[model samples]
Target: MEMTFPDAAPPFLADAGWAGAAIEPIPGDASARRYFRLRRENGTAMLMHAPPPGEDPEPFLRAARWLDANGLRAPQILAEDTGAGLVLLQDFGEVRMREYLDAWPQDEREVYAHAVDALIQLHQLPPGPFTQYSLAEYQREARLFIDWFCPVQGLYVDLKSWTEAWEEVLGPLLARQRPGVTVLRDYHAENIMLDGGLDRQGLLDFQDALVGHPAYDLVSLLQDARRDVDPVTERAMLEHYITQSGAGPHFAEDYARLGAQRNAKIIGIFVRLWQRDGKPRYLDYIPRVWALLERDLAHPALAPVARWFDAHVPAALRDPTGRLGGTFAV
Candidate 1:
């Protein structure tokens, strides 16, 4: 993909005395946003270029400010150009928690505990500026599986029955909670940095934060699609969060519900990244995501949705290579 920089340096960068800072492209995630590490003799900074139509920095700025105020380590904004979707920010260093855990598997427990602590801190914030994660939103995201995943397998399953089944599964769960905790919509290891200078967990890519049930972020973290957080760590983290947060007895069910819902949505997202976004590598993760989804489906609360899946989506559809070739690429 072509990297588009402003005609000149962003005025904000120039104003911040970064006129001759060396520009280095930082790897981006699944989003359109790009980051560059700008280094100079005195200091280092990050330039975020999230070009417009869909990539606005306003919401990110607001959320970062709220988090920083509440004693979390969201990057401090040095400068911004909302018109150009540019932001100059504090550099959070190189090691993502994912990479850290890969290098030192023994530290998984300690690292994940801090991640849990970060969530505990985050959820404690007074309901801030964020949209509610409504049932409509959940259903819409779940439909991505039907929209994108089906086409790859040469099938078109009408999602009316699926949505109806979801209503049966999610209706009670949604009613059990409203917009209470600030859910960092994407809280996986990839978005979390391990910068000891700031906070133990350095938060990133929270531009899509929402006011929702706490279990959603927990699901995102423990049931990560990109990396396997082992069963022991996963169980310990859940118990720790419940103990720390004082969530009631039904917390486990809520976690399972959101975990199922999230994994279901991600199945389509990975497929869509290939079919629509022209990024085929994500297809490799389909099986891992399916495995996680199947586990969540085993929850008793998911019986209705599980029956729907068993009836409609066959076993072949669950495994990426069962019907579609493992080398399936568009």
Candidate 2:
């Protein structure tokens, strides 16, 4: 029995004389949440079916309200039935950044600049109690690489050694960051939409936004797995962010470090997505993400983590980890 909005449609919909509308399923992310496009006499709206008793729509609705209040383009919650996990949200269209970039690669930088600007605006907002990022949380996420990827690839990793080195090197580096800003945990291509009608973009799946490093979202955008953003464009975007934020020359180093950290986390995440979630589509992008990580590691700021990866992980593993649609060559 699949749970759906009709099962939980608000009583007010009937009281207000709203007829049941057609629902079309939309592609979803890794979450169990599902979306449907609904059409009524009035217009179109998005219906979220999160299922009953298992998931709650309150957090998402709260975050959406907070984001909308802050000049961000998160969908406004029209109505919600928290007990049944159903919500009606404003439709933001379906032009995912991935699709937009594929259709016009040349225009990617400009469009992505808009995304970065949105991120900067989000980061500039004052932090709230609901948002915070801790090193312990990051370390736990990083471990997904070892837990999920190692078994899927039929390889044994000395995670104990890796964790010790990771803490010794990357830990302190991340610890130095000034936190307390809205960090959209998955601020990547798929979660952004290029809505032609709005003359602007919209943000999606931002329920995980937290107070963390401002550079984290930047890395998430540029070092995306589903799309390949050129280094030249990435550099220009970085410079644009620096200029806009009025950050000093040291900002470059911070950006590089954050990039390295974000890429490492993604490498682990992609592998886990395939091994645990049956989403092997993400594997093909590993090489590009690894290449970006390698480049960032070359920066002086990331030397410690670079040396740790070089010494612990075999060089031959690079191509094998990245080559999708085939088994590891080495």
Candidate 3:
């Protein structure tokens, strides 16, 4: 189905002085927000349409300003009409980190190192004006597994125990992250733009930024849902971040804990995307995410969550194929 511009788009663009630009639609992710590349004779910009009720542009604007002010490379907002849910932004061009590494896999180490360095620099600063990723928030996200994935599989597990397990496991994790660093929740290869080379990575999709653990974003990067990061590269970049950032000795445990919580959230999210939102393509990533989650669960920190999974979600039902009725769409 073709996606049409919202009723407020034309005037919004015109008022932003982009009335006559050639508009090219960019592919969308799971969100309702739509993006367009606006090419005028002089230059180009990105047009974001985040229609209200389901999406909002204020958080994006806030995070973008904070990141740009902090010397990170977020897109410069050219103009915005928050009421109309439209924003004009400086174009970062097409070379993203994922595609760059795809063409030159040898560049993986270099690019990942640069990303880790960026995170190190980001963590040094105080967190932006955003809510902290509190224990409740982590629990809320983790419960997506119970809310979406479990019911779809017809497994009526103990919700009370699920809650207790997450609380027990995550309480200490949150305790260690007090007065936390800025965590760009969706930080990953796809959201990073190679605008001006690897030294200056352009950040995208950071509207959901929060004050949280530093290790969370690293997990998002190394255990990315859309692509497979080699285990060696994952470990190397992790150690690189720890050594360079002067993180605590327990950083590895924190990484495992966050990785498990994050993977569980993503599993529920992907399942919700397919079953509730009618986009089945996300289902393709479930098995990979399960693998990552399983590895994280093996860590002693996640023993409670691991036990819950052992009783409720068996290894057979862990993959989408087991309960999704057959082979998933490619």
How would you encode candidate 3's per-residue C-alpha lDDT over 62-167 as one tens digit per residue? Answer: 9999999999889999999998888989899999999998999988999999998999999999988999999889989999998988887777888799999999
Write the residue-wise lDDT of candidate 1 on 65-128 in tens digits: 9999888899999988888888899998898999988999999988898899889887777878
- In model 1, the worst 10-residue window by lDDT is 320-329
TM-score-superior candidate, 1 or 2: 1
- Residue-by-residue lDDT tens digits, candidate 2, 1-330: 234455556563453344576667787676678888877777778878776666677778877888888898998887777776777788878788888788888887788889888877877778644656777776676676667655656667777776765565456545445556777778888988777632388888877767777777888888776677888988899989988977656667767777776677777877766766677777777788778878888888776677777775667665524544455222
RMSD of 2: 3.1
Query: What is the model-wide C-alpha lDDT for candidate 1?
Result: 0.85
Clash count for candidate 2 is 0
TM-scores of all candidate predictions against the true structure: 0.95, 0.87, 0.96
What ranking emerges by lDDT with the best candidate at the front?
3, 1, 2
Question: Using TM-score as the measure, which candidate wins?
Answer: 3
The CA-based lDDT of model 3 is what? 0.89
Candidate 1: stretches off by over 4 Å: 8-10, 197-199, 320-324
